[model samples]
Target chain A: MTGSAQPRQPEAGVRYDVFHTDCPARDVVDHVTSRWGVWVLISLRSNDLRFYELRESIQGISEKMLAQTLRALVQDGLVWREVEPATPPQVTYGLTEFGRDIGEPLTELFDRITQRLSPRNAG
Target chain B: MTGSAQPRQPEAGVRYDVFHTDCPARDVVDHVTSRWGVWVLISLRSNDLRFYELRESIQGISEKMLAQTLRALVQDGLVWREVEPATPPQVTYGLTEFGRDIGEPLTELFDRITQRLSPRNAG
Candidate 1:
């Protein structure tokens, strides 16, 4: 709750259609559904992580790419960044309420792939 | 069924970790979760369509992208193509069993976005 970025509040009666060519939600979907985005969101599902922890968990994301991804997610209001006041200034990243709402279905989709589709591939 | 592309069959005992850098499932996730891919899959959920029909239904997809997306989906065994014997050889595309299985959760996610998320944005 300290120095949190201002999240975008949905304007009343502003509907978006992802199927439409110009819908803003398309960008939202694209960001959350991006390969790196999915990995980052799901990795944070268990616990908030330091930047290095997120990098380690996702395996192959470049520092530049991870930073860019985090910036996009924070802008979308799906993830929040917290900077702790300290000698070195600790930082942690976690989902916002909106992030968790979208994360529910996203994680479910991820689970469908890993838990069912993948196991089916296994002998 | 004539002239349909050979779909990849999942081999038993071969596990895939989408979280891993090199897992084939990562490709699968990337494709299906793509902005256009999600629209294509969900469009076909109600009924199969011809190539042009798919392009028209997806709103802003260029012919190249729609064609390319279908080719990838068919190769992954998530979709199948049928060529009917006729003077012009009519063609149609539909989800295979695997496509439908994968599409189930994918559609659920789409619904979560369109039905729930979008409505929340509305006044």
Candidate 2:
């Protein structure tokens, strides 16, 4: 692994090193793996959800934080937002194709933790 | 989805809910996905690494944080610590069988982000 903090060149336009420190990919990981990011993505599943539905799904999350999490996911291109014209404009969020690609692996990782390796069983 | 904040019972001694907020699995997720946890696990990459080697591989991490991170992994059973009987009792850290199970999916999720979903390409 290279030690330099310079931005890494993508491998055939296909990869970046998260270890490089200067890679934008590292930033993306940091954001997605943030405290609420994974929860939001995994909570989304295959269905688009209104903000309140998402808030209710992931208990103890404040509306401010939920909105922030959705915003970051959208900016990462892993999620999309839509506004429904109703009595009150309803904003909904769902995983984009790219989101599902990454979310698939994230879900797998989560299952590994909650299923096979948590303290109760792995011990 | 259950909105109750009670500790979730594992399914057939194998599953726990991370979204329930009261599940121990949630705390584990919060720890493992912290700024350095995923990096450390992915950095191990099927090899035993001396403390300094790990620090070197992951640029910009301080010794205190690395030590703390290793301690957590060791306690979680995802990493094992070995003291090589030597002049200074050299130490090494490596993943346990369980760590490998979880690390596999984490690495896949990471690869998805860097390889297929980074802004430069996902756009």
Candidate 3:
């Protein structure tokens, strides 16, 4: 077989083939876009927030659910957790560079969707 | 209340406040980014496909789930379902202008996430 006829290797660092079930990117997408995940990311867009602050800002999210969502984002490297050394330890969550890179687009999308569905536009 | 001090009325067409549970745009976001919804939108980004074709393209999606996802997107005005008058009554689905508008960004985000999660980049 000619060199040109050989099958090309899957491009490196591109794991987003939706057709492939084993693609790790699918999990990332699921996590970031999950019910609570979207809210968490958007909440952090403007500023870093403490855990309670996040819960307060995102109405209706349970403490357990918020914790789980934050953990998932942290694992995905999209969020950073900072712990303050104090009598009562404090933790604040902020988007990492990677998180911001993705979060910006998501926030824009969220805004657009909301704009489209508003009462004035619901014709 | 002074004229300048008056609270401005909610702008004409803006519906995406995640903080409010009754916000219509939240439902739009949920449906579009849902487990199967994301795949369906991404799949149709390049080309329109029939029901069966969509089922095949998005691995692991059940007929019930696909139907539900398509229905939600259609209701949200992001997907167009066209039925062909043929022996078997072919049905195809494609993105509406609105769908494309949102799909473009979603697809971009999906690509970015996949790129970041690929094994080669998994440092």
Q: Which candidate comes out best when scored by DockQ?
A: 3
Model number with the top TM-score: 3
Cα misplacement distance, residue B96 of candidate 1 (Å): 2.0
Chain A TM-scores in order: 0.80, 0.80, 0.84
- Per-model TM-score versus the true fold: 0.79, 0.82, 0.85
Q: Write the per-residue lDDT of candidate 3 for residues B1-123, one digit (tens) a residue.
A: 223432333654432466767666778888987888888999999999999999999988999999999999999999999999999999999999889989877977887787676555655
Instruction: Quote model 1's TM-score.
Output: 0.79
Task: Highest lDDT: give the candidate number.
Answer: 3
Question: Which 10-residue window of candidate 3 chain B scores lowest in summed lDDT?
Answer: B1-10
lDDT of 2 by residue, A1-123 (tens): 545553544454333568877776787798789878888999888588899999998868999998888888898888999998998999989998888988888888888887764544544
**What is the lDDT of every predicted structure here?**
0.76, 0.81, 0.83
Of 2 and 3, which scores higher on TM-score?
A: 3
lDDT of 1 by residue, A1-123 (tens): 244343443654344667776676777777887758878888888899999899988878999999998998998888999999998888799998877777777777766656545544444
Ranking by lDDT: 3, 2, 1
Calculate DockQ per candidate and list them: 0.29, 0.44, 0.46
Docking quality level of the chain pair in candidate 2:
acceptable
Regions of candidate 1 where Cα sits further than 4 Å from its true position: A1-15, A116-123, B1-15, B115-123
Clash count, candidate 1: 4
